[model samples]
Target chain A: MEKMPKWADVILIPAISILLAAIISGLVLLATGKDPLNALAIMFDGAVGSSRAWGYTLYYATNFIFTGLAVAVAFHARMFNIGGEGQALLGGVGVAVACLYIPWPHWTLALLGAIVLSGIFGAFWAAIPAFLQAKRGSHIVITTIMFNFIAYSLINHLLVNVMKPAGVMEPATASFPEAAHLPNFHDILGLVGIDFAMDAPANIAFFVALLACWFLWALIWRTRIGYQIRQFGESESAARYAGVSPTKIIMISMILSGMFAGMMSINNVMGEAERLVLNSAEGAGFIGIAVALMGRNHPVGIVLAAILFGFLYQGGTQLSIQAQIPKEMVVVIQSLVILFTGALDHMVRSPVERIFLALRRKEA
Target chain B: MDFLLLLDTSVLGTTIRMATPLLLACLAGLFSERAGIFDIGLEGKMLLSAFLAAAVAYTSGNVWIGLLAGIAGSLMLSGIHGLASITFRGNQLISGVAINFFASGITVVAAQSWFGQGGRTPQISGAARFDPIIWPGALTRIRDLLQANLSTKIYSQIISGHAIIVYIALLAVPLAWWILYRTRFGLRLRAVGENPAAVDTAGISVIRLRFGAIMIAGVLCGIAGAYMSTALQAGFVREMSAGRGYIALAALIFAKWRPWQALGATLLFGYLQALALRPDIIEKAIGVKVQVQLLDALPYILTVVILAGFVGKAIPPRAGGEPYVKER
Candidate 1:
């Protein structure tokens, strides 16, 4: 079999898979008696039709970037960190404690403090599973999944029994101080004499996500430790022969993975909600898996993938609300995208490879 | 402390009841993992089957039909997993994740279209739901056989009065042991996991064996789901299986992929569920505060501890997640 060109491998394969997904999703809509064109139009309008929608889309994308990076970083170590949901949950707790306890005078200071705290929290949550996978024979997938459940229960316990103020029936904790509430894009843009949506949750967290993309790119490609992680991920025996410690690589990879996941809470907890709430991490954790897979586990690929998913999420919600499509149908579309790009990838690859091979054979 | 309440037959009954779903799912995972396919969509399969069983049973007014439909639904999904992973040689984990999302979305959409009650099936009643087996007039028989002792009768009640599926689930452990260890197919299955090439050399088709294992896993998961909707409860609800599938996978790991060990692990988890259901019992008995959520988290925490403590023993099958390829 002939190896495909890098451009095709990086761009064309995902594009074809996604196109196939869109076609199949259209068929699914048609089968349900909904107009595919109408659904498509509604989705487009909902996602990027206006500045407000873009705000929601970017806000959602911000969360996905953190989680997607979490999965991608762990992927470098060949570790499928399925515990991002749990790690992100734990990150929320860190944000809650930091925001609720420390009274920062400015939003900038609070953001910095939350970053450190969330990194520590996310890293701590991921460290246990990483440590177990390194030291014990436990599979990371299984352990991380189990940890997701534990994280949910822990967060639930804290919200219901510990954090809720007295006489409040609601399970969420009290709102954070004003300093902790990060400024949204509208607020920032307003300062520069530009009009923007006021209530949109899109905040400085999106910039942080972009920074993370750069950080990951540098960490994976430019640094010696990054080289060691890649080597360990590619082949443990090769790394071990080169005197790299397996335990250290595994632990560090997972901790860094967790830190990224935890930082996601800064977007939801501090940026938008301005308080700790149950399920603030939402399904962004699982969506991260899809993001990582579809992005081919690359930082640039992940950023683009995050934006695409963000569009889908916002658009699907709009379709469901306006077009009366079932809310779960969006999930079905998400599944199809991953199923084609990640699971059934060879379906597109082998045919392309065969064509390329045939062309070469013809030339010969 | 009301020790008696804590030890009540009703509590034990609830534990056994709750354990039924986990037990079936654990067995399902054992079969799949033992054949070298790491099937993580057990929850999805269970959820699908649960929905089908309840929907069918409610519509047909026949619990048996519901069970069959549920099994078929689950098998269909497992077949997809096999096609993707075994045939196309895709990543089993990703395929499993995809199918899970598929099941979650499709079921809710189908449910709403079919029943029109949000994402729930109509509650089943009469002959559609499984009731206690009763074991051929046990009240009179027990009185005559046991001289009407309270403890003896209560003990029988704890052990008996379960739906027929519960007994089937319990009996399956030994059956799983027989097929996995004693049968020729069992030997081939084990060999396939350890080294698929060796199985191929021995004139056994690795694809067929693995596909069969995946199908069997599906059937078992279907039963697990059907039991929940058609037996334990009367209808299906969205995300009804919750994370019982993951709990089962954890139990399977805790057991190290042994059938009998799977039973022990599942029952232990079931006990934890029971404790979670009634945290006050623990609080009263131990004279300390008990967090139900923490109790719910025990399986995950214990699995970690066990993994760390017994690292060597917990290793999965050598080729569990790798897609088997013929010699090239």
Candidate 2:
């Protein structure tokens, strides 16, 4: 084989890794007496085969995008926000309280109340750990993970007793009223021969997430605070000497990260599900870490990574139905992406840097 | 209505039983993290081990062998983590995430294929279980006294009969404490986590030390899983670790990565769990009718509250995540 060009390693590494993973999955399928091509085809078909499937896929992608952005933002601050689940949980609680308990005559007011409350709740949930890290010097990883558990049990209790609709079998609150339901635009579009469930609820939230990403990009690359955060991330001592308040930065980043997560849940509570439910976001928050890593902590990169995950998620379900495979194959694929990305970090960096340097030299 | 009588036994039992798995997991985390390896994947590993312990016990008709199998399985996964993170200089968080996702997928698939069990394994037989060893006279009296009553009765009722694993878990605490504080190995392990280069200069192998710690964590996690499936519940269910591994991790953190401190944190969490489950007793004890939901959230709420308050200055080892690269 021709020796791979040094510059090409940047792209080749992941491309080769993904191909290797697909081959490995293929082999696993064959070993289990399944056709690989058929599985792949079904996965694609299921994800984008029909209008309804595409609609649902869009809805799923929308949620993933927001949470993925949340994770990405924290990663930029060099803080791992694993409490995305907890933050989202509180967000849902906020939305539920706003919808069920708040006195609202107008639909727009109710919607605004729910969104604002969700963000506040999420920020509050995350603020505890942020406070610990800022003031007490607690490790972000463990503290955030612990907080996720607290959120789960706390929500479970509240759902079972206080918030739950009586006679409900599972731990879920009452559905919001019709006025509170965010319209699935796809369903409305159905009257004009354009219908899909996947992206039905795709609305202003997507734009908001995109806008948030842009804002984060500008905040990270442009502003003084962004420079201080990067400086702190690089060397805490130096950043402190430079007059940046490390504690304040830690708290602010965590709260901001968490607020973004709160907005992510608005898709479910205000848009798709229209009610608070247990295990909401499932593990999307965790998946956001993978997105952040794949995106290389770049805002635009996160958008692409989120979309890729969305495709895998949609396609994986299709493959499962078609090939009688477990949909968890998608999870395996995701784990592989993270594994490859992490393992190939060196490859992605030096080669790309070298390429840029060589191009600059040639131009000069 | 003699409600107090019923309340005490249930509270005591729930506290003891609920605390057992958390204790085991916390101890496991304490050991691993003390040596400076992040063990966020404990829940996934424990779930895998628990499922396998139940499966092997159900199949081979030997709980001892099943327990061993679980320990071995966890060790293998831990070894992978050690190799990937320690030897290869891979990211710790990524490796943990991989181990968790891999364990979850592989265990569920294996269970689905082997036992044709959907979401859970079939309940195992009595022989596979760890039965309590009941003793005579004083032990019997102690058992009755400790049985869920809220009187100021302090006796040795705890030794009446619990599965052998329960005693082992309780015993492991002191053993871990001893291993951590008294031994030369413990000092070296701490040294390795704090500063691997210095430890290396001191002629100790950081790689071997960290690997050994990770493996020990795996073995303890295996026991924790075994207790969860056979002793606590009769069968293995999907996600049975149910984030308990993570809780153990929390306990370890709450204790600040110390073996001895973990005992207090785990028990506190257990007490909270017990309180949640036995809300009637809690209500009466506290003299307030707390909504059961709030009661259930006691452990989590307490975790946030306590962690927020005390974890303000719990500094980890200086070279915790940085991989040791030997100079040429």
Candidate 3:
């Protein structure tokens, strides 16, 4: 088999796939009687037009980063953690409990406490499916999907019966204490004699996501457990030959994946909403898969992919508001991107590899 | 315990009504999974069909024409899935996910564009929808129980007064079973899922067989979608399928991909849904208050328990989710 040049494999393949998806999307817009170029301009303006726009984009990107890293971690162990939706929902439970109940005098202290609680909650939720996959021969895919529905009901139940303020009809818990509110980028920048976007939800969690990317890089490449996980993902038979226990690797990797998914609540629930609302996690859990796949399941790659998707999401909303394109059309475009970059990846790669191989053969 | 009191004819009737979509969707899933294809896009296909069915039924004022339109709409998605996963040899799961997103987005946008009613078609009613076919009282009676009492009526009414699609959904199980076990095509279909390479080696067109199976799935999903719009509801709502496809897939897994078992699993899940729908009646019958959220979550909880091997192992077809590539 011919190998693609490193640059093509790392950069060019995704660029062309995305460009193809964009061209097709443009055709779709034109078919619908919309101006594609004007739509693109509006999206660009909405996503990066001002610091406030960047704040919104970065806020969305932060949620994607956590979930994307969650997906990337599991992909290392050859596991698909579709349960991130469920895990993230459960993590909100953890954050809500900590914020609403804890008598912390400071937001920083509350953030630390919430982080540990959310991680534990998410990990515990993931462990059940992990146990089923390892010990009971259940396909992780079906179980995780089932768990997502279960999570929604569970959270709704809690909000309605257990957490809702008395006489409140809506399915939402009380807002967090003022001390529990996470400091946004504006606040942090203000401390350092700088200015930033006001009233924006792009909070300290963005920095946390950057830290997570670096942490994921070190964990997957530098640690012994990471080596074991990669080995197990690459080949179960070969890993067994290397004396690695499949059960241990599966459980640890999935728990870690769930933890990252759980930590996303810090960005969404803790930073953005400041309340544990129904549907807070949204579809970021599912979007994480595309992010991981497009990034080739690497931390750096996932951050980049997450930001790109963030741009799409923010920009797509602008198209709806400004250009009269349906917001759902963005979903169509995003799915097309996923279709090309993730599913039909070889469509771009194989052709590029062939050309590279032909040129090398001619040179030889 | 007054468990028997909870099993009222009304509950059973609701169960039958709710089970129609599940039974149809799972049967659809059974065909796709049995043909070495992993179809998680059943929800999307059903949603698309539901919209088209309602839209056409409203326009044409004929339920049958709407049904055909629904089937055609669903088949279009199935064809796309078949083309991507089989012809393109792409990742089956990714294709399935993409199909789901594509169907969801397309349906809403198209519905909003065409109807301009905020992503819904006009409400269809009476003859435009599937009205219940009530059997004659005398025909539903036993020879000795001709007395028109409540008990006799309960016994007979359970089998009567349902939309035609409900009966079709019930009849589909036996028909699917016969077509699966008692036919030559069924044998080849099962063989292809287990070992497509072996089927390919025998000079059979694996692509055609798989494509045919997926199309059969599309038809079933179309009926399922049509049932939702024309029989259960007046018109299509956005996301009317609402994860029933995923639930049906879980039911399919619990059924171990067998037709009869699929019927039983779907009915069980449907009964759980029915119980959730009538929480007041259930609480009164049982003389105990039940958590509505827990009731809503019960089927999923049962699915997880079953998937955890508490019940037994549910094995998938060996070649399922693997795109069959022709060897050079």
Candidate 4:
């Protein structure tokens, strides 16, 4: 077996995978009787043609970043935590409870409280499955999938019965206090006299997401515990031989993963919607899986992959409105990306490695 | 008498209706998992089949055609899974996940573009949908033969007047049991799941066997999806399968990968679903306002408990979720 160069492994493989995904997505567009080239133009124009589009793209990216980091952190420990959806939903509940119940004097204070509560709530939801996996040998993937449904039902009940204010028919919490509202991108840019989109939901939470990426990078690569997690993921027996407890690594990594997933509510629930609503996660948790896979589980890679998906989401919305193309086209594209990058990786890798090997032999 | 009244024909009938898809899907999962492949994409295959089935049934006005189309659609997805997991030797779970997302997205995209009814097909009727098969004078004959009573009526109704697919689903259990436990193919299938290396050494192609199992699961899921759209409902709705695929997976686990037990588990889950639909009856009987959400979440909760070993342990196939790699 020939080993490919590092650059080929990191950059070349993903580039080819994306090209493959794009080709399939174009074929899908053609099958639907839409012009593939025209659809591409529409997506490009919608995603980055204007500052407002950038605003929406970055806002969506913020959610993906948090969830992506959550998944990447767990992936480092070889745990597939598919419960990010449920964890994020519970995090929204946490944000809602904190914002609606607590009379914070300022947005900064409120944001801090929301962050802590959301993280704790998300971690709490993940802890059960993690405990089951760590102590009882339950499959984390199945347990996490089950937890997602349970969280949905739980949130539905809470929004309908417990949180709905009197006289409101909607299944959502009442608006947060005015002070609890975080400053949007427009307001933040106004501090430096830069004009920006006023209606865009991009807010201070986007910066928080970036900060989370840095935090995760340090936690996963720099810390001693991170080494243990990586070791455990590589081989459980080897980790056990090296005096690293598999149980501890699984619990810590999962809890951290849940915390990141939960913190996503700060961007969507607090900064964007200003109230807790049903289905607030809106498939971002699943999108995180694609992001982590395409990015190869690196913090920087996750940020870039998240932005790409964020573009797809925002652009897909535009295409739906303008060209009558279903927004689900984005989902098809995302699935193709996941398939090519995560599942059929070797389909591209083996060929690419062979090419690299031939190139090296010719040079020699 | 009160207890008997609570367990009336209506309740039992709904239970069977709800359990039909579940039973089919559980059997599908059983076949795949028993062959060492974890197919979390059952929901996706079922969803895609449901959409294709409804769309074709409405257009051609033939339920059987729709059923065939649904099966073909599911097999297509199963082929993709095989390409990724068996041929490419990729992560089986990731392949399943991708297939699920692909099905979910493609179904809605196609439905919305083709029918333009907010991701649903036109309501199918007449011969396009499977109508209930009522045995002539079944109710009267049972009453006359056994003396008129509620119990006899319940028994008669439970035994007759369901969609033909329901009977097929019921018969499939015994068939699946015989195929799994009584045949050489079944032995090879089970053996491959347990230890592919051993199977490989014994001159069997592990890849071919796994692909066979995946295809079988695909066909079963197709029937289940067709039953949902063509037999149970009039047409397709977006995400109509909902989480039934996951619930079926749970039922498969609860049954510990056995055929007869899969039937019992699915029936129990279907009963819970039926009871949830009639919360008023539950409230009256139990004298407590049982939250419907609790009922909706019960299967998941119970599966978690079972997975945690609070109940009898569920040990999966040793080689499940792993792509077999032949040593060079």
Candidate 5:
């Protein structure tokens, strides 16, 4: 067998896999007694048709972006940190505690403090498993999964008792102060001459998330730590022989990965809602894994992959309401992405890359 | 103190019941893993079996048949995983995860379409549920001494009071141990996991043995799920198995993959879970001061701590993840 070019092997296979997935999904729609085109149009409209719909879609993307980055960060070190859900959940606890207990004279500083504290708490949550893996040689996947369950119980306990709002029956903590709420650009625009129907709870966090993605892309592709992490991923023993402590690298990689997930809590606590509710982050952490895998664990690839998922999530909800298709189809789609992406190798990558290259050549 | 006495009974009962499913799952993991197949999809298999078993019990009004159906369903699912991983040489972890997702979607669709229910199946009648198998009139005295206020059926449902199934599950420990340590078949299975090429050279078919082990794991997981939904609760809810199957895998590792050791490890986890769920015990023991939810977190906390400490020396099968291809 001939060895394919390195770049082609990495890039093209996943692209073809996505195309094949799209075709398979279309076939699935046919089998499910639905018109593929109509369903697609409805999904697109729901995700990005109007200004209000577009705002919601963008807001959804913001959370995905951070989570995708979290998964990507760990992937760079050849570590599959499936514990993004736990890290994100624990981070939300930090943000919730800050909003409820931290006394700040100004809303902006308080909100900023809460977000920063979220990163610290998330890093701490991840540190436990990282320490186990680094010091004791425990597998991160199983340990991280165990931590996710622990976080679930711990968060549930805190919400129902210590952090809960007084006189509220719901198992949720107190709402954030008005000053701590995220600033929605469209909401701000409505006050001026621009009269667009933008959704409530939409915010500028999406832009921040987009910028963060670009920054991550630069970090991985340009920086020294990025190279070291990638080198470690390629071969831990070789990297160790080259003087990098496997323990330190694993610890730092997990902490950095956790910080990305922690930022996702901000989108939920500050942007999506004002209070910390039970399972509010909802499997975004797991979905982030799918996104990372679909993106081939590349920073830019993860960003694009996150957006695609965001579209599906935003669109699926709308389609369920309008087209009468089940909203849970989004979950199915997510699963399909993981299923196909998990299996592919050189077979899927080459043809897609050659096609893209041909298109670029024509454009040039 | 009155509270402390109540807490003691609650703890004992909770431990016995909780340990039931965990023990079964740990045993299932031991079967497949010892034979050289990584069975991460135990979670999915258990969930599929739980849903099917409950739905069938409610529909047919025969809990025994439902139990059989659950085991059959899980075995079929596990067979598919075995084919994919063992026969096709696919990645075990990914295949297991796919099975989990597929099981979830299939269960939800089947539940909604067949029973016309949303996420939960119709609750089975008392006649259709697994009642306790009491050992005649004299055994009733032991129940009182143990403060087992619940019916003998409930005790046997998940624990000792179970029909032939409970005894069989316990019996499986030594049986699996014999297969792993005493038999040439066991040697081949372990060799397949450690190094398949060597096993191939020894003229033993690694593929066939791994497939057999995988099937055994699946059947055991199915029975465990059936025990939960039909025997224990007489109903099934969405994601009812939760992640206990994976936890069972953890237990197997914690026990160092020894069948007898797995039983002890599984019992510890099962007890922790029971202690967390029984609120009556918590209130009595701690003077109603602490939150019950905190207790629920105990099992997971202990799992992380135990695995980190004890699993440090766990040496996974050498060729565990590598897809075996015959040298052409």
Candidate 6:
């Protein structure tokens, strides 16, 4: 029996949790000798006061959406794929290789090829840990954490020794060919006769992120494999008894998760930077965990959560620039949100459930 | 001769110094995990304490006060974890992740506000930091030390000069073993991790035991953080824990959660880190250019291999990662 209505479970609890997080963030600001109200006003203005702000906000959102879906998919199988950071790093390598090495006639074809290679690269990274977990009983959490470090080291080696263009001091690859350039929001919006910020990195990749969210929704709710994955998540022994292969579910879910995380490079690496840079993932992989948790692991919820985080990211930059407040203040807020929604959920949940139960009793 | 030089006292000293934090953090993990609580937030706790320790030590000019401040900071974070995971029966892993993010962010934010040195405390020196302790007669010329014997050289070079915390970390291993095996509290703690329901039926308070374990972890992590900032580096740098907490976790698994084995595993990892720091020696010895990243990634890779059972199985506590429910 559900102790709370669906609406309350889906909306009310998250709202309250976010409110608590905000309150705590305010306290942190005050403790640091900053005015909470002034900070909030600045953040609000920088996040949504202008169309250009929306452009930056949406660009950041696009990255979070892809990574969040990656986390959400693995989470459906009750697997914690924290290596989204590492997987996305490898995905950037894939995008770099495809765009830099392949001579593409047009941007559209290059995009397709980059997507495929990135997915392959990300899935390949994820598969090893999945295999270890399936066959050797290694904990996925620990293995994935290790893989993140390995991926970082690999990327560092490649950037410094292998990938840097000749005579370039920075440890990043040369720019991709102009033919592979992705149309930014300015160009994409111009196609429909809509004026947009010229310099904002938001691009067609945003639509691709939306498409992924929709596709994941269908995959999780409309496909047989999704059912099997969720079943395995619910009870491994029960799923085994129902003739579902635990190994198959673990492998498929993790690969799909990796693919989504890898594809995130499309937005950040190809669309925004137009080159592969070190630490290009920019902590979005970890943000995806917070997104997935806050979104309740649902597609629509993830999109909403991703945008909220995007606002935080954009606003945080503005805060650092304009108010002289360190940008990591946003990280403190994000952590509190994760704590309230993900870890201390019952602290809010049980009390809400009791209130609902009492209301029902009063009605009776 | 080159290979023999690799085993010299200076290298051994470096290895011991490098392994101190790992040993402390690994034992911290041991206490927490043994009591049915899986703590991935050791990194955050250590980072927070490292920052606070240095900050306080700089202000107060007392290393002991800084150590206490560090412990207090770690304890505060541990309390939050206990509230989320133990009292509220929430997800332990998520709580850990949150604590890590919180520590990483708050330290930088606070450091910028207080010191304004781009997320680092002022470089501490003299009275504010833990200086290396040199034993009597060890500082004398090698020629005067017992006819310059290798044993005398080893004693003077390898064992005599280290921060006092290094000795504490080494002593902690035997102390951990004794507390975990010889004491009644240790038996109950292990039992709770294996079967919390059984422990509950035996009239032991599972919540209190888990909280006790977590508190102990906080104290050890506090010391580890202090060692890093005040003893090892002389100040706190942003993200200075530098994944040692994770490496310590890997060491915990590599040791199969045993105290003595943990010492061996941490020393091995420490040796690898020391080797990575001296790439010139490695390149000269092997006649090959070995990337430092390779050695940096070796411990994680080795842990993965161990976890995969190629080396041996690393089975965690039977009831680890679960919030004990009276009903379930």
DockQ for each model: 0.67, 0.36, 0.60, 0.73, 0.37, 0.74
- Those runs of model 2 whose alpha carbons end farther than 4 Å from true positions after fitting are A1-13, A16-37, A97-114, A157-204, A319-324, A327-329, A343-364, B1-10, B136-157, B181-183, B310-315
TM-score of the second chain for every model: 0.91, 0.88, 0.93, 0.93, 0.88, 0.94
Estimate the TM-score of every prediction.
0.95, 0.86, 0.94, 0.96, 0.87, 0.97
Q: Number of the top candidate by DockQ?
A: 6
Candidate 5 per-residue C-alpha lDDT over A53-76 given as tens digits, one digit per residue, 9 for 90 to 100: 767776777788888888888888
Off by over 4 Å in 4: B1-6, B140-148, B309-311
Task: Give the DockQ-based CAPRI class for model 6.
Answer: medium
All candidates in order of lDDT, best leading: 6, 4, 1, 3, 5, 2
- In the range B241-310, model 1's lDDT, one tens digit per residue, is 8788878988888888999988988887787677678877878877888777888787667766665675
Candidate 1, pairs of clashing residues:
none
Report lDDT per candidate: 0.88, 0.74, 0.87, 0.90, 0.76, 0.91
Predicted complex 2: CAPRI docking category = acceptable
Second chain of candidate 5: TM-score? 0.88
Off by over 4 Å in 1: A31-33, A190-194, A362-364, B1-7, B137-151, B310-312
lDDT of 5 by residue, B93-174 (tens): 7667667766776676556546656757988877567775655432335556465545543443344444455566678788
TM-score of 2: 0.86
Tell me the deviation in Å of residue A317 in model 1: 1.6
> TM-score-based ranking, best first?
6, 4, 1, 3, 5, 2
**Model 6, residue A167: what's the lDDT?**
95
For candidate 2, what's the TM-score of chain A, rounded to 2 decimals? 0.86
- True-vs-predicted CA distance for residue A128, candidate 5, Å: 1.0
Better of 3 and 4 by TM-score: 4
Q: How accurate is candidate 5 locally (lDDT)?
A: 0.76
Tell me the tens digit of each residue's lDDT in model 3 across B227-305: 9999989999887887889889988988999999999999988888788888778788778888877888887787777
List the lowest-lDDT window of 10 residues for candidate 3 chain A: A1-10
- Model 1 chain B weakest 10-residue run by lDDT: B136-145
